[model samples]
Target: MFTLKTATSFEETIKKSLFICHATPITSAEEALAFFQTYHQADATHNCWAFKLTQSYRFNDDGEPGGTAGRPILQAIEGQELVNVAVLVIRYFGGIKLGTGGLVRAYGGTAAKCLHQAEKEKIIPTTLIRCTATFSEMAMVKSRLWQEGVQLISEDFTENGVCWILSIPDEQLDVLSAVYTNITRGRIFEKIET
Candidate 1:
């Protein structure tokens, strides 16, 4: 999966109707709602939208025909294999009526264009792990984690040992766990956090 690196927008006129598409990366439904509320046009004819987050997704046609606006916008996002993204398409009617097909094309095309123009980055699946090691094993553990590209989130030193919080890519978890065990002689304890 991929996601936009920054907010982006595109505007075009179709059949004399103004269509403006705004796309933003969002990790949660609350952020998606906030983006819609902030960018929605009060006086425009419609404010259609769509968002995709992992296994969840939603779309709104606003006042346009049932599937004319929102679904197409969603298809555009999915077509690019984008996740954790929200797209809002605002329309200002210019008195020229566009058929349902036209509306779909306009909204979906605008959204596709906006996302295509924006910079994107790959989404790396990550897992959080908390572990404890004796002070004598700290240096080796930290070194192994760093060599495996594990992100050290926090470290707390206790009288008994050092507690570490790390973010490890899903693909590297097993390798890191093995390396940690080998380096510490199976003395360290680890817990995975969701």
Candidate 2:
């Protein structure tokens, strides 16, 4: 799965209706809701939205015809195999009405265009590693991990050294484990999980 590296937007007028779509990568449902609320156009005819998370998803027609607005937006997101994304399409009626089919096409097309133009990044699966190193080994071990793209989530100073909570990409787990073992001789390397 992939997600937008940065938020993006697209605007177009179709059949005299103005449609503005905002697409953003989100990490949580709360963030998605917040994005929708932040971009919702109170003065528009409708503010439809949809979001796809790793394990969950939701869409709102926002008073549009059932299955007309929101579902198409969600389909656009899924069709692109994107996760952790939220899309909001605001419509300002321009004194003309688009049929249900037109509405779906307009909203879905707008969202697709926005996402297509966005910069994307792959979602790397990661695992948490807990390791303890003596004071003397700490600097070297931490520097090597950083060089390998390991992210230090937290560090707790212990009596003898520092216990590190690291986020390591799954593809590099084996290599990192070997580095740790070789550096510390497997003395303080503790556990890796999740």
Candidate 3:
């Protein structure tokens, strides 16, 4: 799956009506709703939107024809193979009436264009690992983690050692565990966070 690297936007005029599309990366329905609240234009004629998450998806036409605006935007996101994203298309009627087809083209095309223009990154699944190591082993563990491209989430000093929370690529857990064992000579203990 892919996701937007950053927020992006595009605007265009169709049949004298203004269409503005804003695309943002979102991980949950709450974030999607927050995006809508942040970007919805109160003065616009419509605030159509669509979102795609791993487990859920939704769209709203916002007074446009039943399937004209939001569904097309969702289709655009699917066409790009995007997940964890939300797109809002705001329209300002300019006294010109665009038929359903025109509305679809305007909203969907604008959203697609905006998304195409924005940067995208692959979604790498990750697993959290907790490691406890003696203070003397800290330097080596930190170096190994850096070499393996593991992200250190938090570090806590304990009476016996330091506890580190790390995010590792899910596919690399076994290899990393073996490497850690080797580095610490089986002194450091590691476990995957459930």
- Evaluated against the true structure, the overall lDDT of model 2 is 0.89
**What lDDT tens digits, residue by residue, belong to model 2 across residues 77-107?**
9988899999999999988788899888998
Worst 10 residues of 2 by lDDT: 185-194
Taken over the whole model, the C-alpha lDDT of each candidate is 0.90, 0.89, 0.89
RMSD of each: 1.4, 2.6, 2.7
Candidate 3 lands at a TM-score of 0.83
Model 3 ranges with Cα > 4 A deviation: 135-137, 181-194
Against the true structure, candidate 2 reaches a TM-score of 0.84
Backbone clash pairs for candidate 1 read none
User: With candidate 3 superimposed using the best TM-score fit, by how many Å does residue 89's alpha carbon deviate from the native?
Assistant: 0.5
TM-score of each: 0.95, 0.84, 0.83
The RMSD (Cα, Å) of candidate 2 is 2.6
The residue-by-residue lDDT of candidate 3 on 1-194, one tens digit each, is: 89999999999888888889999999899999999999989999999999999888999999999999999999999999999999999999999888988888888998999999989999888878788788888888887765465788898999977888898887877777887889878844455756
Pairs in clash, predicted candidate 2: none
